[model samples]
Target: MNLGLTPSVACVKPKPEDSFAISFAPLSVEDVYAKADDPANGAVVVMSGMVRNQTEGKPVVALEYQAYEPMAMQVFYQIAAEIRQKWSIVTRVVIYHRIGRLQVGEISVLVAVGCPHRSEAFEACRYAIDTLKHNAPIWKKEHWADGSSSWVSIGACETQGC
Candidate 1:
């Protein structure tokens, strides 16, 4: 019955350093990067979401973000767990999202992933941000230059490419 088979040893992965926060203050790329930094990491990829000056050709004056804090934080943790499952080599995951009114060019969110390789770090970082955008209980209000304001749906991001 044995066909030259050997019992595979179970690989034990180190506990990944994960940080998640729902903040009212501004998000800093350097801060998140530092959180995701690990001695075992060869690369740390960071994605920073910012308040753009325009949306769908409309001039945007500012954006106001709101979130269900408790649930959003839970979702952030879930995202990190998912990343670990998908990329076992991931050393750390850091996600920070800012709420409140923000002017154009301001940072809104930061997602960073540390891994032993550049490709996995980049992929894991991208997954964190994209999943957060769709799954987190967060909302945004866009203020137009014409003094009109509209609340945006999270689903709109998929269709309108927001």
Candidate 2:
């Protein structure tokens, strides 16, 4: 877990057996939601983004994801910062997004937010995903049946369900 936390920001201490749980992984939901049992985090909001097998009514074979690492990390930090600034009650926020080849139903991204209040957690969680879609510099290539692949250049405005 490359938690790039700086001294300027609040240092996140590993939850003491009861704080909160948030995760993203290529494995399974069990691995991702291991912290759900934390008692301190009363509310847990989980969001999973999956790769669809079909695109534009076409039969998709596979997908390849690419990301500009530096920019993507910046964007991820920005989203987390925005969520914290916008909400006063968000306790813990976890987001995991993958960059590589993917098949249908593969989990592309996962976000989880824990807070004392359910409303704040929900708002922050949703905001994180929406912002990531709009800001992350990640691209995808769709493979078709005939061995042709096309890139999906998702701009900030277009990706946020705009």
Candidate 3:
């Protein structure tokens, strides 16, 4: 069987044991980099997403995350396979996403990819996030200080402000 990444990317919510460290609170770039380190890993690229206070000019109080665990896992595995097959330089990659209660200024997700060179690492890491956003089942619920909240769906406009 070929252990190669597919042309299309998939996203998953990795198990804690399979991940460097998985938590609902926040993610750390340093932690991801530390786990991604290896003798064979010459280059490491890291991406961190922070919870912004505003979306479309509105203030966000807090956020809740939910996911479809089984599908999420499947997507993640496919992503790993695809990356391995497409990129010769990339050796390993780690993607950590938080699903649960999260506050502002907290890390929502982290992606780290290691390769033989910086370019490959960067490409793989970037691809991971973009694909995850497109394919993952993770959803966000934004709470407002005015005693109101709304479930923010993926692909929705939450960039303005919460």
Candidate 4:
């Protein structure tokens, strides 16, 4: 049976071992890792995206995140499906993203992949985050120390070295 939020994609049922969510509360690495943990897997690789203190040499105080929730959740399911297609040994996939203002050092996103081998786990986890960054309908505003703020596009990672 599928769990977590329902996928907006038609005819696509998310696996019971796979989970996705967009939350306003602070994300926890331990909780995300546990969600991806499985006895059938030897490795669970997790990638935690945190709000950092600086960006492009500018001091940052906090970040505000927003998402088109339905679409973002659909993209999360697509990412997990792609991972499973690429790594058949993958046992679980868990993705969580935070929305609202987040202070520096706070977790913003977490992507975890469980696989029987470390290599596949790492590769799948990397793929999940990269895909999410590029495809998810999520946006973030950087709150600068200078009392300024600006919305950053998803492609900002490519041009701004994020």
Give the number of the best model, judged by lDDT: 4
Q: 27-140 in candidate 4: lDDT tens per residue?
A: 888999999999998999999999999999999999999888877787788889989999999999999999999999999999999999999999999999998888777889
Model 1 regions more than 4 Å off: 1-16, 155-162
**TM-scores, one per candidate:** 0.85, 0.74, 0.79, 0.88
| Cα lDDT computed for each candidate against the true fold | 0.84, 0.67, 0.71, 0.88
Greater lDDT among 3 and 4 belongs to: 4
Instruction: Give lDDT for model 1.
Output: 0.84
C-alpha displacement of 152 in model 1, angstroms?
Answer: 0.8
Predicted structure with the largest TM-score when compared to the true one: 4
Tens digits of per-residue lDDT for model 3 on 43-161? 98888987889888889878888876565656566666667777866766787888888889888888888788888888888887887776666688998878789986662123213
In model 4, which runs have C-alpha deviations exceeding 4 angstroms? 1-11, 155-162
lDDT of 1 at 76: 80
Model 3: per-residue Cα lDDT at residue 63:
84
Residue 73, candidate 3: alpha-carbon lDDT: 56
Residues 1-162 of candidate 2 have per-residue lDDT tens digits of 868844222333333322222223364555445643245566888888888878888888777777765556666666666777798666666667777888888987777777777888888889988877777667789998778899885534255542
